[model samples]
Target: MASSHPRVLAIVLAGGEGKRLMPLTAQRAKPAVPFGGIYRLVDFALSNIINSHYLHVIVLTQYKSHSLDRHISKTWRMSALLGNYVSSVPAQQRVGKHWYLGSADAIHQSLNIIEDERPDIVVVVGADHVYRMDFSQMVDAHIESGARATVSAIRQPIALADQFGVIDVDPQDPTRIREFLEKPVNPVGLPDSPTEVLASMGNYVFDADALVEAVTKDAANPDSRHDMGGDIIPAFVDEGTAGVYDMIRNEVPGATDRDRYYWRDVGTIDAYFDANKDLIAVQPVFNLYNEDWPLYTGYTGLPPAKFVHAGPGRLGHAADSIVSPGVLVSGATVAGSILSPGVHLHSWATLTDSVVMDGVQVHRHAQVHRAILDKNVVVDERARIGVDHEEDRARGFTVTDSGITVVPKGSHVA
Candidate 1:
């Protein structure tokens, strides 16, 4: 039986090799990417933890974590005096380790600290996503199920399901997942319904003792892959009972609205761009304005976003976009795009169906469309970027056939 007052600890995995979201993630980690106008990608997880009343949060960081570390220090400086705190535990070469080889290895190296905390449950989450979830509910479900681990599962369209880790569950016992397929070519045949598949949300709650034991044991295995999903969970599941918590609307009244049940894995540049665009929609599926469940982030201390010389006739209007604080859009027409903080748009520069990141300066007469521009990029005057797919490809930029050009951060384009 689980304890009534379980001290839950959240271990956030922020040490991913973000290969797909290149340029933006070339220098910084994926979790530090700006999203939804003002907030970083990892803010979603931290807010969820704070809202759920969990104070002890440990973010495990590695692989170009300078920007991520800075963001955590600036935004998440909680009070130690009040017995609540959030801290980053970077990968140290203390254990004769160069860098965390995998998720399990990261935790394995940190077992001493985890065991010292002596918490009842350990909630592990991937930081590079945009979602609002009450992790306490997942913890409660884990206790109720009396399982070693409880994985949060979501239903997705079958065609896209194979791109994620798909699970096979028993009809009689929905919680009893039978098999795990990591990005299968054909996941439709593995699920009960042909149209939908049960996908892992990468959010997990584990028994603290079981987790520590698994990590220590798995670390000793010579031929193992040393990943949580690849080895730990599957090994524990084969040995004992592990449950699956469906990503359905929770029973928490006035809290778990249907629209609030949103989770995204923005692992690729296209996915990251699309997630940002969703926030600017009129009736966005992922509502950032839900006051009842406010998404908390760092205080900018800056004034609200301002738009100058924006009117119908002037043609310098910002249309269907979110312009964040301290932005100066002067005499430029922006349509279906998001402009992050400190973005300066000179006269006649047009942005259409794109995402311009923080500190970007669009010079006069430049046109950017169907693209994602990283931070601090300077678009020269009269330069037409993301104009045509063929042109962008010829210029050594990654322009998909659909005309989505991805400009990696800190890249120079003449």
Candidate 2:
């Protein structure tokens, strides 16, 4: 019994500093960081919204958002004649002369956009997650349940509950959220599955009036964190007006059984690297080639990738990898890696289990393994990376605890 169509406005939160993802985030915001060779992290969220037929979108941005702003402006252009737009709204300090204190504070400050649009339901989502979801289904469930706020919940193992905001549901009402716990050490398991807990996906569908009232009240509280997951959600849970939308129940077109519920929060270096590596698998857990629910981004006009030269001990070949456009694998042996656009590999260069970003030049006999080379990095002849942690750290490069060496942007290896 849901309405045929409701006035929906999508708000994407893209303001996190992403301090945990350093070096990669040094030059741009987390959402602006390139992913899967061509798309940015924010592209996943925006694609989902657009694919769901929600065209009126506003991205709230802060903390080094120049690249993020430019991406949205250039790529997400919608026809203004049709009343569609994808705008990036920065912190304007409309209420005070200070920056956004938290997520709720961000929305509280940008009330003007919401008021101007006058949407009946506001769908707010985070910018740094990789997932595909048809949010229109969640909206229907929210309307049917008559909840003031609806949070998208994903089933995560109980052992990993400490990593997220766990949701405790009422025993009698499976849809009603009993409590909201932030990174709980001992989380309550679901009724049917003892080893699984419902974790908030940081996506919410809010009744427009409820959202306005919650954020407005939270703004006046002196001790509140004013975060969406930390403050606004807990307030609605206290009022028994918050419902949970099971992500497992939401169906997206062209989703395989192996990738139906695929979602990753690439918040750290290892996590980001692992997520990128996930694409090279024979059967990726998160498939990128699903054309039915395609992931959209800015199109580059680069030519197709090329592989040249076939000499003794110097074969230009790549196995189990994704090589983007304009990449030239010249007499290089690439295995289990991702080569971004415009990467040029010289003769005898071997890259294994690594991510080479755009415009990188790997010289002859250089060996790269389990490493990330940022944009415009040049590896000198026979230079070794991800081979020695001590040497890498001494050379001012970052070496994660997992031993993933990262060469920052425009660095030359010798």
Give the per-residue lDDT of model 1 (tens digit) for 204-227.
899898888888888889888898
lDDT of 2 by residue, 23-141 (tens): 99998889998888888999999999999999999999998999899999999978999989999999998999999999999999999899999999999999999999999999999
- Computed on alpha carbons, the lDDT of every model, listed in order, comes to 0.81, 0.93
Candidate 2: regions farther than 4 A off: 1-3, 191-194
Clash number for each model: 2, 0
Worst 10-residue lDDT window, candidate 2: 1-10
Q: By summed lDDT, which 10 consecutive residues of candidate 1 come out lowest?
A: 249-258
Model 1 RMSD in Å is 2.0
